[model samples]
Target: MIAVDQHPLGRRGTVVANNAGLVVMVKELADGDRAVSLTNETGSTATISTTADALGIANRGPYRLKDPWTKVPSTNTTGTISASVPSHATVVHRTAPGPAPLPP
Candidate 1:
């Protein structure tokens, strides 16, 4: 909670999706990046999704996602930002436009 609030990308949030047990919020950063929040309000796990257009991000290239809480890295190349969130849990990600690095 503190880490998310204190992170620079975690400000200026705008709710993009809120329904079906999934709530999503987006924050545009100054460095051409985005902070996206996926919250699951259901008793069971849920899959939440949003688009780059919905996130107000103009660029359409591949994007990289890093979890502020977990420090886990992922990628999105489908213009869609989706996540499988645990019940009543919130997953926050930092999205930046770029290609994912090759895995060795």
Candidate 2:
């Protein structure tokens, strides 16, 4: 599952975590950082933090937060997070399991 923000930032990684307030490009990623690439409703994709707040950085994982499906990423600005991040928690954010089979 992935969350996509409907905003354009150059032409890089389109996939993004709507729950994340920041976006990233696939080319510039550090080792051990999990990123989810999402294409928004507008067809633009960006990389988003899969971890909750700073916890993603501390734990070396993607920034994962509450249910992102509940809301969409704000195109106006970086959405403010009402919740706080707890100490020492890591969540895995990766491509969904399995591959899409070609049409026979």
Candidate 3:
């Protein structure tokens, strides 16, 4: 994870990439707002959140996969902060499999 602290005003923070062809960008707004953006290599960007306090926000991105998703070059922002699947990406919940019965 890339940690950016005290980033300059009007400047973006750190950027990270994953094997899934996704790029994540962290931005520090001039008005003390923090935001996170996820973009594919194709240049499609999805903004996660823009809030003064990152701790209070529960930002969720659209990217979801059946396989495990890993973030390359782990990232973290100090001051405050918070997508890439798609504009229609929505939350998905999977039910757990039940235990098999013992043979009679």
Candidate 4:
């Protein structure tokens, strides 16, 4: 895909979560943003979650998340990044750092 090919997560990637049919990974982009990928391969829906600290994002706090497929933009203030993902689907988010928000 054009998007995937264009934006690549550098070599410093971390697998934040993983299991039989689900996987979550994150990496810091060249510009200091982040790429968080949540994948579901089973026959049921799944809720994937992780913290920015786990994602290796050491920024202050709040972060902006944008899903490439849906073009929906969201935010994270508690360092928690989560999503309700459908079966056999993958949600890739491009998160940009924002001003620090309150703690979790």
Highest-TM-score candidate = 1
Please write out the lDDT profile of model 2 over residues 1-104, one tens digit for every residue: 23223322222344324343333223112333223332222323433343223323332222332333444332221222222222222222232111223567
Every model: Cα RMSD to truth:
5.8, 16.0, 16.7, 4.1
TM-score of 2: 0.19
lDDT of each: 0.78, 0.29, 0.34, 0.75
* Candidate structures ordered by TM-score, highest first: 1, 4, 3, 2
lDDT of 1 by residue, 1-104 (tens): 35556666556688888997789998777677778999999999988988877887645467778877676776655578888899999888888876434567
Instruction: Report backbone clashes per prediction.
Output: 0, 14, 3, 0
For each candidate, what TM-score against the reference? 0.78, 0.19, 0.30, 0.75
* Residue 102 in candidate 1, Cα distance off native in Å: 26
Give per-residue CA lDDT, model 4, range 3-75, as digits (tens): 5436565355578788888899876676667788889988999998777887776565677888766767865
Clashing pairs in 4: none
Candidate 4 C-alpha error for residue 63, in Å? 1.0
